[model samples]
Target: MVVWNNSDTMEPTFILRAFPGLEYVHSWLFIPFCLAYLLALSGNVTILSVIGTESSLHQPMYYFLSMLALTDLGMSLSTLPTMLAVLCLDAREIRASACYVQLFFIHTFTFLESSVLLAMAFDRFVAICHPLHYTTILTNSVTGKIGLACLLRSLGVVLPTPLLLRHYRYCHVNVLSHAFCLHQDVLKLSCSDARINSVYGLCIIIATVGMDSAFILLSYVLILKAVLGIASREERLKALNTCVSHICVVLIFFVPVIGVSMVHRFGKHLSPVVHILMADIYLLLPPVLNPIVYSVRTKQIRLGIVHKFGLRRRL
Candidate 1:
């Protein structure tokens, strides 16, 4: 039997486990995690700098790319400190208020990434299907508004999560499943009825991830329809080629998300290591891969990077 504590009298700190059952190798695990963080940071920052400095990349697609880069940076920064502490130093205790704050940023940025990906999909749709009106449709003013809307929507939906969790009393087990705090992970530790939290969480996931993914797919369908209508096969391939990077990014973001959700819902009987590995992959893979995908696939970005490093002359 488990005992519940009163919210008013409960301790303020919660322990975070890097891997609850597999703690012996946590120090060893820090090497790859640290390398991933460094790569993600350097890759995203390079993309941002390249995009910002290159006047040619001032178009709508690159604007959305910059937004993606920013979200990746935020996602990486949000979890970096907690991850380092838990993996390297074994410092796992975090205050309730701090945990809530971290949870807010993590979820916000995650949703923000979804929103940005949807925006990028729209940008691709406009570029491929209606090339002439792309500028008019996604003007600087309009792009700014869309970016603001994404940020605002993410914040509005995630803002209530921490507040709701703060009211729930946690029982004996306050150890989180991962190095960082996630809304779902934190909610599970609460002893009180968390139907509200769970319901809200499901609703937000459906509203943002579900809705954005559906629309992104719709956009791609329209893009495919447009591409197929082209008279030349070469032109059709060329048109589809532009979307390969975005498609890879969408898969990188959503596949892990779906896997994590599935694991949470149905993998309870599985090892704790499976859950931890899935969660870490969901959080870490996008930031690390998004810039790499874009840098390799987009010519302008590649040239910009080359020019930035004075490698153009060498090549």
Candidate 2:
């Protein structure tokens, strides 16, 4: 089992165990990861640059896309570097402090990304449900505030998590279930009682992701109702088409976020390798897929990307 480097106190509050057969699986996983990492970065940067340079894209929808790209970049950075190191540099077992910081930012960025998605959903809701009033509803100042809210909301939820994690004392059993220092995984290593940690984690999930999902559903509910009343079949179909992309994004993100949380809490006996791999998938999957989804599903972003990349003759 991999051990934390913080052995100065002779008692570890954080436990991380080395798993068998991980090196093999770990080695093979990075191949796709490298490709995914490059693609995600390229796609996000292309979006940002294209939107920034093009005056026509200075609108609410593209503004949200720019923020999405930025958040995706952050999401990728949070896990990929350390992940790549683990595979390539033979570096395993991070320091407890390092682990806590990683936990904080990883949670923060993911939370922020979720908020960005929620904002995008609202954008579509307004644009489709009230086309004439879309600009007035989703103005530049409002978009900027929404972007800032993503950061604030993430930090607000994340700040308490590490503080809660720290109160526990490590007496015995410091082996973490997975590679990176995940909250629940790290909680499992605590020699002291972790009831509060578990409760707080659940509360945060309910408060943040659960809260966001609820609002998203409500937004779409209103959107659907409004669309249904519309006389133009073409307009209704167009609105629904826009929603399809957002729906795919929501499923891709929330499923794994909630899934990893459940597996960590309930399925303790699952292979450590599986635990690590799945957790990584949760972290990386959204980033890897975000750009692809946007490029293919979002016409504006796809045009922006193709034009900026000089892939074909400029129209």
Clashes of each: 0, 10
**In model 2, which range of ten residues has the least summed lDDT?**
11-20
Query: Distance (Å) between predicted and true CA of 252, model 1?
Result: 0.3
Alpha-carbon lDDT, every model:
0.91, 0.78
Cα lDDT of model 1 by residue, 136-176, tens digit? 99999999999999999999999999999888888656777
Candidate 1 regions exceeding 4 Å error are: 1-11, 312-315
Best model per TM-score: 1
Candidate 1: clashing pairs of residues: none
Give TM-scores for every candidate, taking all chains together and pairing residue i with residue i. Answer: 0.96, 0.89
RMSD value for candidate 1: 2.1
